[model samples]
Target: MSALLEADALHLRFGAVRALDDVAVSIWPGEVVAIVGESGSGKSTLLRVLSGQVAPDAGGVRYAGAEVHALGEAQRRRLMCTDWGYVHQNARDGLRMGVSAGGNIGERLMAAGTRHYGAIRDAAAEWMVKVELDPARMDDRPGMFSGGMQQRLQIARCLVTQPKLVFMDEPTGGLDVSVQARLLDLLRRLVGELGLAAFFLTHDIAAARLLAHRILVMRHGRVVEEGLADRVLDDPRHPYTQLLVSSVLAA
Candidate 1:
């Protein structure tokens, strides 16, 4: 099968800083790929470029047979709303604080032309339960929920539309250890159940190991290592990757 998303020779810069250099990426349907690196390593920048949130200076990206950069503003927005899901590190950024939790998930359905109120509400409630949230809390505002709950709600909102590809940036960031573990477990199960193709951006090797089938290690805006998750982590070839794994071991 052709790649669900494919990019070749990506290069991006932010003035004097090089955010991406000769980067390439590919994800097939139902495949989970993780990008891992330290802060300022361009992990998040690579994700932004692939998801069409940021334009690469010299590169081409194709998603579902369409050239991403060539898409019009309205076309891009429509694709983002209906076919793609992005989970921000901060739930507040991805969520609508002004609306109820159910409303947030239902909004995606509405964008997809689902008009019946009952159907929207029912789908929202079911997703809430799937993400381990209480269905009874559907009417609560995101701000009223705890940080972990809000993150789970954000996930439900993203996944309710059943998008084939999801871009998740540190979904478990800033949560308590127990909460993070619980959230990771929930995410793992949901990804399997939904057969999602996902890009998981994380600094935590363990988290990547738990969710990703393949791993890419980045440093200085370039991918230094790429392979099956187990092979890369177990016998890392690149010096940077070896150091990364050793540092995690030392910790």
Candidate 2:
């Protein structure tokens, strides 16, 4: 299987702090790779770099076999025009609060250079349905919805473009326990059904086990351990991985 996304020898730094230190990972088509790390472990930074939000200090990022770092700003923007969606750790970061739900999703189509109003609206409605949201809520602003619903809307908006790859940062954060579980279930189903490849970042080991086929465990800005979820979580080789697993089991 070809890698849908690849990062090789990636390194990034902010002032004196190194965020990503020679880290590497890859995702193939139709695979879900969970990035598990404590805060400041560079998981979010990796996603930003992959999405072209943060340029790496050194290393290579190749998407669909194209050299991402080599592209001009306009060329990269055009390449990513509608081929990617990002759900930030905070739903608000991924949404425009003033816009109606339908408008939020429609905005992506617009950015992709789509101009037909009817087509954009229809696409937004279809995405809302896929995320299990009611079409009637299309006119509602995200401020009117529950936290869980807002998160779902963000997901719907990003996945609407039928992007081959989606990046999610701590997606279930800030929701109540039950709401988190429900959203996770919905996300798992949507990814499976749509055959979308996801790079899901989470600090929660249990969530990683639940949602990922492969797990990459990070500590101090490096992938300390990586393997199939069952192997890494069930038989952790790194101390940090063991600690993470133990904490989840204890909780």
Candidate 3:
């Protein structure tokens, strides 16, 4: 499969601390790729660089053959709204707390050029059901919902646009284990059913194992190992990766 997104020779720095160095990666259409590492290992920084949220000091990112940094601000914003989705570690970062749940979902549809009120609401409601949220709660504000519910609402808002690619950062980070498991299951199903290409960043090896087809292991701002998820996680060659896998298994 051709790469839907690609990053080459990425380098970034923050006050003498290297956030990323000589990194290269790609995400194919309908593929789920995870970046796993300990905190401050540059996993999140690489996600930002690839998704156009942050500009790298050096290197380039291309999405569907278009140079991301070369696009105008308006074009980049439009691409994000239309063809790409980003799910932040915190639901609040991706959701509009003041808007009604349905309104939030409808906003994306509207941005995608769906102006009909009835059609917007219908699509929002359908997405709510698909994400396992009750349509009856469509009028409620995100603050009225639980953490898990808010995350689900956020996912619904993003997927309602039917974006070709989605970027997720520590998607289940703050949830309880049970909640995380359920959310992961839901996410796995939705990504498969929609054939969405995803770039997932998480420190949780279990989450990576559950949801990623391929895994990239990072340490100190460099990719230490990468391969099919099961193979890399089960038989990691790098010391950092072996430690990561062992720690998860021992937990």
TM-score, each model?
0.98, 0.95, 0.98
Candidate 1 local lDDT, residue 17: 91
Best of the two (1, 2) by lDDT: 1
Q: Score candidate 1 by lDDT.
A: 0.94
Candidate 2 regions with alpha-carbon error over 4 angstroms: none
RMSD of 3: 0.9
Ordered list by lDDT, greatest first: 1, 3, 2
User: In candidate 3, what are the lDDT values of residues 1-251, reduced to their tens digit?
Assistant: 68898989999999888999899999999999999999999999999889898999999999988999889999999999999999988999999999999999999999988999999999999999998999999999999999998999999999998999999999999998888998999999999999999999998888898899999999889999999999998788999998888886555
**Candidate 3 accuracy as TM-score:** 0.98
What tens-digit string does per-residue lDDT give for candidate 2 at 44-156?
Answer: 89888887888999998999878888878997776665777788878999999999999999998888888999999999998888887898999999999888899999998
**lDDT (0 to 1) per candidate:** 0.94, 0.89, 0.93
User: What lDDT score is found at residue 75 in candidate 3?
Assistant: 93
Go through the candidates in order and give the C-alpha RMSD of each one to the true structure. Answer: 1.1, 1.5, 0.9
Candidate 2: clashing pairs of residues: none
